[model samples]
Target: METIPSSDFFIQFWGVRGSIPTPGKDTVRYGGNTSCIEMHVGGKRLIFDGGTGLRVLGKSLLKQGPVEAHMFFTHYHWDHIQGVPFFTPAFREGNCFHIHGALPADASSMKQHFCERVLHSNSPVPLEGMHADLNFYELICGETFKLDDITIETRPLNHPNGAMGYRVTWQGHSVFYCTDTEHLPDRLDENVLHLAREAEVLIYDAMYTDEEYSNPKSPKYGWGHSTWQEGVKVAQAAGVKRLAVFHHEPNHSDDFLDNVAIQVQEACPGAFLAHEGMIVSVV
Candidate 1:
């Protein structure tokens, strides 16, 4: 694993968009790639999801030579796993990746899902062509595990085919990655609250606006996505320090997001919209 000194904790957003990749002039400011994020904590490299942004992140990692990281996936959705085939580091000789994810709803292991399902349809070469030391670790929702000095907790989320949320804590700071989850109408999600309670940062799925979510013309209810307004509620209820409004709606253009940013700031004074290439430090 690539190591860093000190007790620094950082979260970098490689992709912030949700659903699908939207590359165009209108989305240049926020981002075009689907969900991927990187976390550096306690001298360890941690990655969340394998969206298209992972490919871009891979290119940057090449400058650092051979590397190792712990990769975690929320679900096997196409938008989340499409970057696996293009992640350049995975095809390199000396690189290593310890992949982790909750088992598929079906009777398959993490390796089977990634190698057979994800890679089979996307990659041009077989696993043999990828020279990296790849290791897959199966995870269960609501389970807690220790990664060296880091403590990670996983919980189930409300999403189609189910998705998992992760809470990473090291030293005393914590960061919750809770994307692709839908909020309950009657009450806030208790599962999300448990992982995000009093945390330094909560990276949430805010893929629609209240207006967009409930629009009679195109209702987003039960779509496994939440609005930024709901994200603020979760933050306040959990006593979270900062809320990162992530998982941008694919069709939301830069100008559209710029408007949402203002609304988010107004609703939650401490919260801000998450954007591509944005990095937040958890202190």
Candidate 2:
């Protein structure tokens, strides 16, 4: 395990889009990749989700030489795990990765799901054939764990097939990653509030605008995504210092997101739209 000096913490967004990868001119500003985030805390390389952005992150890790990483999954949805096969480090002999996630009720283990994802029918390369040393851990929701000097807590989120939210704390600074989740109307989710309470940063799912989420003709109420408006409410209730509006809807273009950012700022002055390649310091 890697250990950084105390109080050193940083987060980088490799992918911010939700549902699927949307590569094209319309999405160039925010990004086309799905949900992947990289956090460096207490000198450890901690990754949240393995979406399409993981491929690019893997290449960057390779350039830095052999590495040992801990990757946590929010769920096993296609967009969240689709980049695993393209993660170059997984094919490298000297690299290693410890995968962690809450297994679904139907899945035997995290390893099984990963193997199934890379099976002959789904991927060109097989998980068994990967050169990197890989390990898997099935995390229980609400459990707390430690990596070096960093502390991590997990909570179940409201989403079809189930998902997890994570809170990471190091040297008193904290960051919460909450995505692919739906929030109930009129009240903040206690589970999410617990993970986000007083944190330095909160990265949340804001996949739709309030208008889109509540559109009578095409409401996305049960679509398992929330809007930035809700995110602001959560941030305010949790007393978070900064809010990162994440999990961008696939069809939302750059202009639309710009408007969303403006709205988010007006609602929550400390909040900003999460975009590919954006870096934030937790302290």
Candidate 3:
């Protein structure tokens, strides 16, 4: 048996965008942030992804002082890793960061995905100079690992760039994070469903609307993302207790995302949208 948090394990979203950051008037309510999430378990803090949301989360973490951090990256897509250089902790020598990610299918190594100047070289910011003690690991699908009391499982996602989804479990409760995945023949897979089955919460990619994603003219079928309806279907099929619609489309306005949330609730009964600062506790 694993040791669990002291009755206070929680997960919080710091960023929730699909492809890029879209901060502006229309996105303020639901937030146009990118993909970063924080987990607090057994007094340990683990960060998932380092998208634009890391800029803000980094500031908050700086104020909180030195602490160990484990960062999990779904993939090396720009939107998922561009904010690592902006994370304040990376500049502090006292901080240590363990970064875990999925290696590109054809790439020689995972580092090849993020180390080229063609990606972030034009900008003044670069990840190479970060002062923190950094360690990187590549995770394989079906492999299980531990952090504090939590057990984690990874699976490849149906994405053009080969992204991955994660399932984190603690205290016998689970939360599955599936961002930036496209629906293949079906939106959900039995392997993924099994990983998420009876989960306390399932945070999923909800970057398009059924009408937008399924329409012949608008379908982003090859784009590696899904609509709210697809997310609901996956959650229901997985037997998740609650569903969190995450990775909102950059163009989806607050009102638009809100309506999607309502519709997801209508479909799944206990569904909600994942905002920049929302914290969820699962017993």
What stretches of model 3 exceed 4 Å from their correct place?
1-7, 105-120
Between 1 and 2, whose TM-score is larger? 1
lDDT of 2: 0.89
How far in Å is the alpha carbon of 99 misplaced in model 1? 0.3
Error of 1 at 156 (Å): 0.4
Distance (Å) between predicted and true CA of 70, model 1?
Answer: 0.2
Off by over 4 Å in 1: 1-7
* Cα lDDT computed for each candidate against the true fold: 0.90, 0.89, 0.79
lDDT-based ranking: 1, 2, 3
**Tens-digit lDDT string for candidate 2 (239-267):** 99999999999899999999889989998
79-178 per-residue lDDT for model 1 (tens digits): 8987888898988999999999988777478888777877875577677778999999999899999998899999999998899999999998999999
- What ranking emerges by TM-score with the best candidate at the front? 1, 2, 3
Model 1: number of clashes? 0
lDDT of 2 at 96: 89
Candidate 3's TM-score reads: 0.91
Worst 10 residues of 3 by lDDT: 1-10
Poorest 10 consecutive residues of model 1 by lDDT?
1-10
Clashes of each: 0, 2, 0
